[model samples]
Target: MKITKLQPTVVAVPYRSEEVWAFGRRRGQISVLLEVSTDEGLVGIAEAAAYPSVDIVLAVLDSIEPLVLGADPFEIERLIRRIDLVGTWHHVRATNPAIAAVEMACWDIVGKACGQPLVNLFGGRFRDEVECFYYVARADPDEVAAEGRRAAEHGFRTCYLKVGAGDPRTDLDRLAALRDGAGEHIGIRVDANEAWAPGTAVQLIKEMQRYGLELVEQPTSGRNLAELAYVRSRVDTPILANESSWTRYDQLSVIRAGAADVLSVDNQMDGGLLNLKRSAGLCEAAGLPVVKHSLGELGVALAAAVHVIASTPNFRYANQAYGANLADDVTLGYGGGIESYSDGCVAVPTEPGIGVQLDADRVERYAELYRAEGAAFAFHDDQPRGEQAPALPKR
Candidate 1:
């Protein structure tokens, strides 16, 4: 059936705690939810992380409206190629989340039309459920320990914490606390977000290894694969590539450079769900495991990724999710808080399409929230702008 209309809604869902990273902090998740209505009366829904900014994502949707309005929902590949080549968005990685949302909606449409779940259509279920790590957003040593205990008590296999946002001593203390509270069984993954230099990364990782790191993510800058390789060679902790592997092309370069032990992939960062599968396959061929990265998504986007992750075998480790941080979700009951997860895993939905339906009331509530205070939810720092610019490879 032909596509009829695109309905876009911006929503801001509050987080249980602030998501602190190397660059800045956000108190909530801002997403642009898209509903693609078709001529056959089928409506496919998806959400795009308001990466970079909400205006950019909205602008991308507006620019792609003409390209998607009359197109066939089943022609995902051709449609995406048209959006990339014809729309001249092929070179613009920042515009990917919007394009990905549209593509995800199309896949939802395709699954509904075929009377099959997206997992089956993609490659069948290689797994029944996809495991996700509990995100520990706090930085205080006591808070980190408490979050770690909560993660372990919830039966989570992994706990992800953001590092490189402060001094090395502070990060070490937090890591030690997490290890103490989470115990020895639960794996601890730390993401630096490209904040450390090669020497600092090696030295810091060596010190942090005492706590038993499961993975050290993007210790050095992503722009230089050699730097990543150097740090990886020096540290016993396996390096997980984030910014270095945003796209399939970047992933290939990472593989060639032998920069990381594991590669992180994101559909929103790349283009679509199909490309997510392709990324897994590419990494699988290279004998590398893939972890699904997040740009801070809601249930709609989380569900879409779950279908692909379940259908793919290369997702060996627990993937990233905001469930531990999200206070509430717009969707009925899919993914919101730690309660949504059973043993740190979300089961694949058996219903046709993406399987999760948006709760109109909650959606409206969050939409209103976005309209009222969306700017505060964006990727921003508490520090005043221009006062102190964050330099890379912080020494």
Candidate 2:
């Protein structure tokens, strides 16, 4: 097989509204897409899950170019794991996604070449559709209620609300409104996004406990690990680790500390497929539930995540996936609803090679929007570097 260097392209898709978190908030997210090419006119593509910097996405892809440029397209795992000799943990986060980009691309190539679907490579399918959840954060208590009502009306039995980062009074008020709007039929899940402290979290969660909510994600602040564990001990509600659970060892830490009852792992942010696989295996071994977390990724990684979620039998909690209310066209022909539901459960997709394809023209249009949104151009003239300190002495 022939190898062609991959390149980074930026795309921006509009959110119907925005999903607020501990980090400021935004109405739209920038997407970075990497396209891999091989001989016999086949193509594979993957997208990084985070947008902290689109350049990081490109830098990652560029860094792995040398390792994958001349390799066979079918030796996916061997090449991905072999590159670990450079640095497993560090490079896994930095360069592995770019490598996953290539791996995903190669899967597409080989799947098409052999007329086999991607799940065949993964050993076969266990799921046909992935269940989904919808996020609701209007900041207005009434609006929050309205959003909850809409979710329920749309047949979404679960509501993922954004709390914490706002005023405490607002959080409580909105929680009340949300409960009322969803009534007793809907599952209520709150994501604090790590906006509160241990003590306040205990108090607030205790109040939220009265509602018999589903789970609280990162209720306490993320900075203090000890306090996180303490908050877990204090609350009766199940604690789902968001900010704190990033690795296999992290899964162990959460279990050992008795901090989290469930784990929400973002495959892209924690790293790509390699780390996600490792983390999933770890969670399975530990007998803990897993919730798929996505950073507003489009079809590629989103569909990849569906495959992973389906493959893992122990990931019983609802996965934080896209209802896919946003994509004009998806990798697969299917679209995720605003949230996943049937009897109020998400369904995993069964398609070949992640089951989604990017529209080149649409992606290009978003790339232009991303450039306009300023992924590479920044002008910040007034940020402190550090306090004045003595210079280092020459060796």
Question: TM-scores for all candidates?
Answer: 0.98, 0.86
Error of 2 at 105 (Å): 2.7
Model 2, which residues run further than 4 Å from truth?
87-99, 221-223, 324-349, 374-395
Model 1 over residues 1-395: C-alpha lDDT tens digits?
99999999999999998988888888999999999999999999999998878898889899989999999999999999999989997766444799999999999999999899999998899999999999999579999999999999999999998899657888888899999999999999999999998998999999998888999999999999999999988888999999999999999999999999999999999999999999999999999999999999999999999999998988999999998899999998999988899999998999999999999999999999999998888877767878887889776
- What are the C-alpha RMSDs, in order, of all predicted structures? 1.0, 5.9
Q: What is the lDDT of candidate 1?
A: 0.92
| Minimal lDDT window, size 10, model 1 | 88-97
Taking all chains together, the TM-score of candidate 2 against the true structure is: 0.86
Candidate 1 residues lying further than 4 Å off, grouped into runs, are: 93-95
The numbered model that scores best in lDDT is 1
Give the per-residue lDDT of model 2 (tens digit) for 234-285.
8888888977775555666777776788887766655455467668778778
Indicate the residue-level lDDT of 324 in model 1.
80
